[model samples]
Target: MGILEKISEIEKEIQRTQKNKATEYHLGLLKAKLARYRAQLLEGSKTSGPKGEGFDVMKSGDARVALVGFPSVGKSTLLSTLTSTTSECASYEFTTLTCIPGVIEHNGASIQLLDLPGIIEGAAAGKGRGRQVISVARTADIVVMMLDALKGDIQKELLTKELEAVGIRLNKKRPNIYFKEKKGGGISITATCILTKISERMINLILHEYKIFNADVVFRDDCGTEEFIDVVVGKRKYMPCLYVYNKIDQISIEEVDRIAWQPHCVVISCNMLLNLEHLKEMIWRYLHLITVYTKKPGKKPDFNDGLILRSNCTVEHACHAIHRTLVQNFKYAQVWGHSAKYNGQHVGLSHKLSHEDVLLVTKK
Candidate 1:
């Protein structure tokens, strides 16, 4: 049997098995096996065939966000409305056949928006160029799960499952599990706090399944079995996802209000051009981007142009962003913003910068 068949069998077994304390270990083992098979299947697709056209677009801009959802859900229309790029839009599904790239300029930062082809059911299993689409999504800094307002819940669940099957954890942080492979000592498991979801025996089984005989594991937080499996596999992508419900004009006001109130969700209508600005703002906020201004000695900071950087970035990062060799001869920097201790405080390269901060770097 092939990997998919094996995955299907294990899934079936897991579904048939009873859910209780007695069968937890069995379920954990089955899930670990399923995750392994799915990882292998995705890895094998790398060399399965030639990549489709326009799928391998080069990464650009301050950050990248991918528009992923079912067909005819307004991905193309959203891209066209948000950026200069005009993606072909129609009243039918599958209008976008390739990755269409665009730029969304907001808050002194240029965000790259990719309108990927709509993914169908079983997308993670290589159905309808799903692998290619997901591969592109893996490269993005964030994913925008665009859905139709009418069938938002169903589409969101299906898309989340497909992305999860491909090892994409949307709107989640990496489990606080410190795992290191060692050569000599046997598996040593340590927990900083109580682990209610997964047991030590379950961990051992899952680790042994991956042929991890000797390793050090520490659970800094209480995580589930699947999270431990993810740490063991160590191939998952954890990124923020924005659930964008487009075509809200077709939906009722009550339904729109309900979706808008949800966390990490935005309700908009591309054809009617409603709530698009708020959608952009939510994207920026989820990306956690910041803008920093640069100043010369005895000169005012240029407010028109600012350095776009991720939150909690240090001065060294700013130096590198300015020039690759700036950090090599860097001495110290002066900051004047929220991150600074005082006005124009002298700080080292290790100093973290905040949004709208003014920076002045002095090189050796």
Candidate 2:
């Protein structure tokens, strides 16, 4: 049978098979087979490269975020409102046939926003532009799952499944598993923490089924068979997602209030333009961005324009961000912020920088 047909057969078998102590290993092996077949189907389809028509969307700015939802769910409207870009809005399905790029300039950080094609129920199975749309999302730092307030919240589950099928893991941290393949080691497994989710035997079975005979595996956290499978698959993208409920003007206040209580949810109306700034703030916070101001010799730090860095960025990262060669010729840096002690303390490249910190780099 073909790859898609094989994937279908494996999925059916997996569903038919019940979960129990005896079947966990079998289930894991089935999952591995399913992942490989799915990979074969989408192998060279430009999930990574988005240039030249097929999956075409050039990435830009400090970080990239994508808007994903069903057509006519106000994704285009929201994009148009948020950034200086135009996305065709219509009452019909599939108005956005390609990825539309826009820039969100917030707190001196320019974040690229992508409005991708609307996905249907069978997107993961290559229905419509689902595969192509998900490819862009895989590259995104954040995914904004836009939902229609008028439409029932079922789209939430559907969109999630579609993204997951394409190996886009939302709101999940990479497992604490460290895996390294060797030419000759014969499959060694080490767990720093006590195992609770899955046993060592199960892990061995899964790895062996995937032909991972010689490798070093370390588990730092108590994770499940699914997480271990994801690590073995090794193509999953762990990203933060914000569930944006648009067209809230059509929903009742009580309903909106209740939906807002859920985690990673924001209620807004694109036509009415409500809670846009709040949404922006939520995106910024979830993205874990830290703004660090730089000060030259005897110059005042520009607080208005901050250097946007990821949460755990270091002084070396700051130098690299300023210039590619800055890190090589760098001597030391002076910092005056929460990351340093006293005003303008001299620090090395390994020094971790905090939000709103002032950095002064001196090169050789």
All candidates: TM-score: 0.96, 0.90
Clashing pairs in 2: none
lDDT score of residue 352 within candidate 1: 93
TM-score for candidate 2, please give it: 0.90
Ten-residue stretch with the least lDDT total in model 2: 46-55
The lDDT per prediction is: 0.94, 0.87
Q: How good is model 1 by TM-score?
A: 0.96
Summing lDDT over every window of 10 consecutive residues in candidate 1, give the lowest-scoring window: 244-253
- Residue 60, model 2: lDDT of 78
Q: List, residue by residue over 156-233, the lDDT tens digit for candidate 2.
A: 988998888778899989999998889996989999999999888888888887888899999999999889888988
Model 1 error, position 176 (Å): 1.2
Instruction: After superposing candidate 2 on the true structure, give the runs of residues whose Cα lies further than 4 Å from its correct spot.
Output: 44-54, 324-332, 362-364
